[model samples]
Target: MFTTGSVDGTVERKAFFGSMIFETVKQDDGALGITTGVENPVPLVILFLVLTAVLTMIQAIYRGLKQRREQLLEASDS
Candidate 1:
């Protein structure tokens, strides 16, 4: 993503995909500007998969413990 404001108070914004390689240019008013590059989606996908697996394991453990507690209570009552 890139944003810029002109002397006339008009602001412009843009977004692009792939890597984020940027170049800084010095304008006539001694101001700075940025340029963006490409995008990468592999890391995000892997993170999603790992989080899903962790949540599934936590839910399974919780269910098992709840069932065990119920069985223990039933045995004591009998």
Candidate 2:
């Protein structure tokens, strides 16, 4: 989840990661401010990539089956 606020013309942002929360506020002097929370996100990234690949394969297989069924029907009609 994310929330944003403004203080004296400066923008403040809050982000949540699991149970950790990080806050970032832009300074009025035009400097960037950031707060760090958890450091490693590699495992989450890898999991998402693997899940995407599996879903793509499943969709491709379903599409191929539908196309094959349609071709068989067309052949029977001829």
Candidate 3:
């Protein structure tokens, strides 16, 4: 994809070299558009971080419960 910007009867052009690309432009009429692009990474990174934190918290809770169960079993066996 290629991107360029121009205003009020001006012409702009650009070229991109990659599997995918993004193009944004502003027209004289104050309208804008993103021509092409996919898989924006910033939002994905944020989602990944949130999921990781939740999984870590769940694992910690599970470990705590397991330890408590073992302690109770040992006390009962004695």
Candidate 4:
């Protein structure tokens, strides 16, 4: 997919390479579209970062709990 945009609007098209489906895109229900607006991807980027942070936090908590359990078992044995 490639896009060429001007202040007026943007021309967007999608094509599948090395696939027979590429021809279909040019026929009925063509993948060509025109979009007129400024695009903001910041929210999506922030959301991805937030999700990664949450995942890391969860992993850290799980590892800490596992380490504590091992320590408790070792202390009890001694």
Candidate 5:
């Protein structure tokens, strides 16, 4: 007969081990294309990289225009 504390400990251990087993199964060699509902995840990463590059280019252009305007104002004021 298991006491309450032992039962609780066993349950916690089981949960921990269960998660480890699940992760191992997920990483198995033949597990790549067998899963459902989950995507490959690489395309989303590529999309983010492309968006970041575009935003960086836009920021560079805006900064260049701002600096040019400031230079023009300084030249006129001098």
Candidate 6:
């Protein structure tokens, strides 16, 4: 979640990451305003890639086991 508003003369930018909140006040001595959303997207991208790889391996293993089980069942029936 993200939001922005003007507080006094400073522009307050806020973003919520799960339970963590980041605030950036654009005042003369304060920090610069943050982006409306994610600041560093690299970590999220890496995590997505890792999860995708793991799930793919799991799916492949499950399919192989199921196919083998079906083959054995057919053989036993015949």
TM-score of each: 0.55, 0.51, 0.50, 0.50, 0.50, 0.54
Model 4 lDDT per residue over 1-78, tens place: 433333223434433222211111122353444433324555556777999999999999999999999999999999
Which is the winner by lDDT between candidate 1 and candidate 3?
A: 3
lDDT of 2 at 6: 46
Number of clashes recorded per candidate: 6, 0, 0, 0, 0, 0
Candidate 5 residue 45 C-alpha distance from true site, Å: 0.7
Q: Write the per-residue lDDT of candidate 2 for residues 26-58, one digit (tens) a residue.
A: 666866576656544765677789999999999
lDDT (tens digit, per residue) of candidate 5 on 1-73:
1122322222111222232211122223433222222234555567779999999999999999999999999
Candidate 3: list runs displaced more than 4 Å.
1-39
lDDT score for candidate 5 against the true structure: 0.49
Candidate 6 weakest ten by summed lDDT = 12-21
Model 2 misplaced stretches (Cα beyond 4 Å): 1-39
- Scanning candidate 3 in windows of ten residues, the lowest lDDT window is 10-19
Q: Model 4, stretches more than 4 Å misplaced?
A: 1-38
Return the TM-score for candidate 3, rounded to 2 decimals. 0.50
Ten contiguous residues with the weakest lDDT in model 1: 10-19
lDDT of 6 by residue, 1-78 (tens): 223355534343333332233555455665565544566666667778999999999999999999999999999999
> What local lDDT score does residue 47 receive in model 2, on the 0 to 100 scale?
71
Model 5 earns a TM-score of 0.50
lDDT of 3 by residue, 14-63 (tens): 33323344556666576666665543456656777999999999999999
How does residue 21 of candidate 1 score in lDDT? Answer: 44
Residue pairs clashing, model 5: none
RMSD of 1: 7.8
